[model samples]
Target: GYHELRHRRVYDRIWIEYHLIFSDDTSLQTSHDISHRIEDQVDHLFRKDEVIITAHLEPESHEPQFASTRDEHERSPLPSREVGP
Candidate 1:
Protein backbone atom coordinates (compact mmCIF):
# COMPACT_ATOMS: atom_id res chain seq x y z
CA GLY A 1 0.00 0.00 0.00
CA TYR A 2 1.08 3.59 -0.68
CA HIS A 3 0.17 6.66 1.33
CA GLU A 4 1.40 9.25 -1.09
CA LEU A 5 2.21 9.60 -4.77
CA ARG A 6 2.96 12.52 -7.01
CA HIS A 7 3.52 12.92 -10.72
CA ARG A 8 4.62 16.05 -12.49
CA ARG A 9 5.63 16.98 -16.00
CA VAL A 10 7.19 20.26 -16.95
CA TYR A 11 8.30 21.06 -20.45
CA ASP A 12 10.16 17.92 -21.54
CA ARG A 13 10.94 16.68 -18.08
CA ILE A 14 9.01 14.15 -15.98
CA TRP A 15 9.03 13.48 -12.24
CA ILE A 16 7.50 10.70 -10.16
CA GLU A 17 7.55 10.12 -6.44
CA TYR A 18 5.93 7.29 -4.50
CA HIS A 19 6.34 5.22 -1.38
CA LEU A 20 6.94 1.46 -1.59
CA ILE A 21 5.98 -0.97 1.15
CA PHE A 22 7.83 -4.17 1.89
CA SER A 23 7.53 -6.86 4.47
CA ASP A 24 9.08 -6.18 7.86
CA ASP A 25 11.41 -9.18 7.46
CA THR A 26 13.01 -7.78 4.30
CA SER A 27 16.61 -6.67 4.60
CA LEU A 28 17.84 -3.19 3.79
CA GLN A 29 20.03 -4.40 0.95
CA THR A 30 17.19 -6.40 -0.54
CA SER A 31 14.91 -3.40 -0.33
CA HIS A 32 17.54 -1.25 -1.98
CA ASP A 33 17.88 -3.71 -4.82
CA ILE A 34 14.13 -3.84 -5.23
CA SER A 35 13.98 -0.05 -5.43
CA HIS A 36 16.65 -0.09 -8.11
CA ARG A 37 14.62 -2.51 -10.17
CA ILE A 38 11.57 -0.31 -9.80
CA GLU A 39 13.57 2.69 -10.89
CA ASP A 40 14.89 0.81 -13.89
CA GLN A 41 11.36 -0.02 -14.95
CA VAL A 42 10.43 3.65 -14.78
CA ASP A 43 13.56 4.60 -16.64
CA HIS A 44 12.72 2.12 -19.37
CA LEU A 45 9.37 3.78 -19.87
CA PHE A 46 10.78 7.31 -20.08
CA ARG A 47 14.09 6.49 -21.74
CA LYS A 48 15.23 10.06 -21.18
CA ASP A 49 17.80 11.61 -18.89
CA GLU A 50 15.37 14.37 -18.04
CA VAL A 51 13.03 11.99 -16.31
CA ILE A 52 13.38 11.38 -12.58
CA ILE A 53 11.67 8.79 -10.41
CA THR A 54 12.08 8.48 -6.65
CA ALA A 55 10.77 5.57 -4.62
CA HIS A 56 10.89 5.60 -0.84
CA LEU A 57 10.94 2.22 0.84
CA GLU A 58 8.93 1.60 3.99
CA PRO A 59 7.94 -1.41 6.03
CA GLU A 60 4.39 -2.73 5.78
CA SER A 61 4.03 -2.22 9.52
CA HIS A 62 4.22 1.53 9.17
CA GLU A 63 1.40 3.25 10.99
CA PRO A 64 -1.72 4.90 9.55
CA GLN A 65 -1.41 3.03 6.31
CA PHE A 66 -3.63 3.92 3.37
CA ALA A 67 -3.77 3.25 -0.34
CA SER A 68 -3.33 5.99 -2.87
CA THR A 69 -6.42 6.51 -4.95
CA ARG A 70 -7.39 8.42 -8.08
CA ASP A 71 -10.09 10.53 -6.46
CA GLU A 72 -9.05 10.52 -2.81
CA HIS A 73 -10.21 14.01 -1.99
CA GLU A 74 -13.48 13.52 -3.84
CA ARG A 75 -14.23 10.45 -1.72
CA SER A 76 -13.79 12.29 1.55
CA PRO A 77 -16.86 12.68 3.74
CA LEU A 78 -16.37 16.43 4.15
CA PRO A 79 -18.84 18.59 2.31
CA SER A 80 -18.11 21.75 0.39
CA ARG A 81 -20.17 24.88 0.92
CA GLU A 82 -20.58 27.93 -1.29
CA VAL A 83 -21.50 31.35 -0.04
CA GLY A 84 -22.10 34.77 -1.57
CA PRO A 85 -23.16 33.70 -5.03
Candidate 2:
Protein backbone atom coordinates (compact mmCIF):
# COMPACT_ATOMS: atom_id res chain seq x y z
CA GLY A 1 0.00 0.00 0.00
CA TYR A 2 1.48 3.29 -1.12
CA HIS A 3 0.22 6.49 0.46
CA GLU A 4 1.46 9.75 1.94
CA LEU A 5 3.06 9.48 5.35
CA ARG A 6 5.34 11.52 7.62
CA HIS A 7 8.50 11.13 9.67
CA ARG A 8 9.73 13.16 12.62
CA ARG A 9 12.59 13.11 15.10
CA VAL A 10 10.57 13.60 18.25
CA TYR A 11 11.98 14.89 21.52
CA ASP A 12 11.56 11.36 22.82
CA ARG A 13 14.25 10.40 20.27
CA ILE A 14 11.77 8.18 18.48
CA TRP A 15 11.27 8.20 14.75
CA ILE A 16 7.58 8.94 14.84
CA GLU A 17 5.20 9.64 11.99
CA TYR A 18 4.34 13.31 12.18
CA HIS A 19 2.22 15.88 10.39
CA LEU A 20 3.55 19.43 10.40
CA ILE A 21 1.62 22.65 10.97
CA PHE A 22 3.94 25.65 10.66
CA SER A 23 3.38 29.00 12.32
CA ASP A 24 5.27 31.76 14.14
CA ASP A 25 3.67 31.12 17.51
CA THR A 26 3.97 27.36 16.98
CA SER A 27 7.75 27.62 16.66
CA LEU A 28 7.99 29.93 19.65
CA GLN A 29 5.85 27.69 21.84
CA THR A 30 7.95 24.66 20.94
CA SER A 31 11.23 26.40 21.74
CA HIS A 32 9.73 27.36 25.08
CA ASP A 33 9.06 23.74 26.06
CA ILE A 34 12.51 22.55 25.02
CA SER A 35 13.90 25.09 27.44
CA HIS A 36 12.02 23.22 30.15
CA ARG A 37 11.95 19.53 29.06
CA ILE A 38 15.59 19.91 27.93
CA GLU A 39 17.13 18.85 31.22
CA ASP A 40 15.10 15.63 31.55
CA GLN A 41 15.45 14.59 27.91
CA VAL A 42 18.97 15.96 27.39
CA ASP A 43 20.61 12.55 27.19
CA HIS A 44 18.48 11.83 24.10
CA LEU A 45 19.21 12.74 20.50
CA PHE A 46 18.24 16.39 20.81
CA ARG A 47 21.21 18.68 20.32
CA LYS A 48 21.96 20.92 23.26
CA ASP A 49 22.03 24.00 21.03
CA GLU A 50 19.01 22.82 19.07
CA VAL A 51 15.56 24.25 19.73
CA ILE A 52 12.28 22.35 19.98
CA ILE A 53 9.71 22.07 17.25
CA THR A 54 6.11 22.87 18.13
CA ALA A 55 2.82 21.57 16.80
CA HIS A 56 -0.69 22.80 17.35
CA LEU A 57 -2.06 19.77 19.15
CA GLU A 58 -5.78 19.46 19.68
CA PRO A 59 -6.95 21.49 22.68
CA GLU A 60 -7.25 19.69 26.05
CA SER A 61 -5.43 16.81 24.44
CA HIS A 62 -2.29 17.63 26.46
CA GLU A 63 -2.92 19.79 29.45
CA PRO A 64 -0.95 22.25 31.54
CA GLN A 65 1.51 22.62 28.67
CA PHE A 66 4.56 24.18 30.18
CA ALA A 67 6.24 26.98 28.24
CA SER A 68 9.00 26.52 30.87
CA THR A 69 9.88 25.00 34.27
CA ARG A 70 9.96 21.41 35.69
CA ASP A 71 7.78 21.17 38.78
CA GLU A 72 4.83 22.48 36.75
CA HIS A 73 5.65 20.19 33.81
CA GLU A 74 4.61 17.17 35.87
CA ARG A 75 0.92 16.50 35.56
CA SER A 76 0.13 13.26 33.77
CA PRO A 77 0.92 11.46 30.60
CA LEU A 78 -1.87 11.77 28.10
CA PRO A 79 -4.36 8.90 27.91
CA SER A 80 -3.84 6.87 24.72
CA ARG A 81 -7.20 7.95 23.32
CA GLU A 82 -6.46 11.59 24.04
CA VAL A 83 -4.11 11.56 21.07
CA GLY A 84 -5.71 10.27 17.89
CA PRO A 85 -5.62 10.16 14.12
Candidate 3:
Protein backbone atom coordinates (compact mmCIF):
# COMPACT_ATOMS: atom_id res chain seq x y z
CA GLY A 1 0.00 0.00 0.00
CA TYR A 2 1.11 3.47 -0.79
CA HIS A 3 1.84 5.81 2.09
CA GLU A 4 -0.53 8.64 2.87
CA LEU A 5 0.46 11.98 4.33
CA ARG A 6 -2.00 11.71 7.22
CA HIS A 7 -0.25 8.64 8.65
CA ARG A 8 3.24 9.94 8.13
CA ARG A 9 3.99 10.80 11.72
CA VAL A 10 2.37 7.68 13.12
CA TYR A 11 4.04 5.44 10.60
CA ASP A 12 7.39 7.06 11.11
CA ARG A 13 7.14 6.70 14.88
CA ILE A 14 6.25 3.04 14.76
CA TRP A 15 8.85 2.29 12.13
CA ILE A 16 11.45 4.06 14.22
CA GLU A 17 10.37 2.19 17.32
CA TYR A 18 10.79 -1.57 17.75
CA HIS A 19 13.41 -1.52 15.06
CA LEU A 20 16.28 -3.90 15.74
CA ILE A 21 18.87 -2.54 13.33
CA PHE A 22 21.56 -4.61 15.08
CA SER A 23 21.27 -7.52 17.42
CA ASP A 24 22.43 -7.35 21.00
CA ASP A 25 25.15 -9.84 20.25
CA THR A 26 26.54 -7.71 17.46
CA SER A 27 26.55 -4.54 19.52
CA LEU A 28 28.24 -6.22 22.45
CA GLN A 29 30.64 -7.96 20.12
CA THR A 30 31.81 -4.72 18.58
CA SER A 31 31.79 -2.89 21.87
CA HIS A 32 33.91 -5.56 23.47
CA ASP A 33 36.29 -5.78 20.56
CA ILE A 34 36.81 -2.01 20.52
CA SER A 35 37.18 -1.90 24.26
CA HIS A 36 39.72 -4.71 24.13
CA ARG A 37 41.87 -2.90 21.64
CA ILE A 38 41.71 0.31 23.66
CA GLU A 39 42.55 -1.54 26.86
CA ASP A 40 45.50 -3.19 25.17
CA GLN A 41 46.89 0.24 24.44
CA VAL A 42 45.87 1.82 27.74
CA ASP A 43 46.10 -0.45 30.78
CA HIS A 44 42.87 0.64 32.49
CA LEU A 45 40.65 1.87 29.75
CA PHE A 46 37.05 1.20 30.82
CA ARG A 47 38.38 -1.27 33.43
CA LYS A 48 36.04 -0.01 36.09
CA ASP A 49 33.24 -2.25 34.77
CA GLU A 50 30.05 -0.85 33.34
CA VAL A 51 26.90 -1.92 31.60
CA ILE A 52 26.35 -0.75 28.03
CA ILE A 53 22.89 -0.61 26.57
CA THR A 54 21.68 -0.05 23.02
CA ALA A 55 18.03 0.68 22.39
CA HIS A 56 16.25 0.47 19.08
CA LEU A 57 16.12 4.27 19.03
CA GLU A 58 17.08 7.12 21.27
CA PRO A 59 16.03 6.40 24.80
CA GLU A 60 12.53 7.54 25.59
CA SER A 61 13.75 8.74 28.97
CA HIS A 62 16.50 11.31 28.47
CA GLU A 63 18.29 12.91 25.53
CA PRO A 64 21.13 10.58 24.54
CA GLN A 65 24.49 12.06 25.44
CA PHE A 66 26.94 9.16 25.73
CA ALA A 67 25.19 5.96 24.68
CA SER A 68 24.02 5.14 21.19
CA THR A 69 21.34 2.99 19.59
CA ARG A 70 20.36 1.30 16.32
CA ASP A 71 18.09 4.23 15.67
CA GLU A 72 19.21 6.07 12.57
CA HIS A 73 20.17 4.03 9.55
CA GLU A 74 21.00 6.89 7.20
CA ARG A 75 23.33 8.47 9.74
CA SER A 76 26.16 6.12 10.70
CA PRO A 77 27.17 2.49 10.60
CA LEU A 78 27.35 1.91 14.32
CA PRO A 79 25.34 3.32 17.23
CA SER A 80 26.86 6.79 17.27
CA ARG A 81 28.25 7.90 20.61
CA GLU A 82 29.84 10.99 22.13
CA VAL A 83 32.30 8.98 24.15
CA GLY A 84 35.95 9.93 24.48
CA PRO A 85 39.15 8.83 26.19
Error of 1 at 37 (Å): 0.4
Best model number under lDDT: 1
lDDT of 3 at 61: 26
Clashing pairs in 1: none
Give the per-residue lDDT digits (tens) of candidate 2, residues 22-65. Answer: 22344556644533343234323334434343322322223323
lDDT digits (tens) for residues 1-85 of candidate 1: 3446788999879998878766678899998886776666666666654778888888767733442332442231112222121
Segments in model 2 whose C-alpha atoms lie over 4 Å from true places: 1-43, 48-52, 61-85
Task: Quote each prediction's TM-score.
Answer: 0.68, 0.19, 0.25
Write the residue-wise lDDT of candidate 3 on 1-85 in tens digits. Answer: 0011121123213211122232334455664555443333332333343323222322222333222542433233334454465
Candidate 1 stretches with Cα past 4 Å from truth are 1-3, 64-85
Residue-level error in angstroms, candidate 2, position 23? 23
Pairs with steric clashes in candidate 3: none
Given candidate 2, what's the lDDT at residue 2? 9
Question: What is the descending TM-score order?
Answer: 1, 3, 2
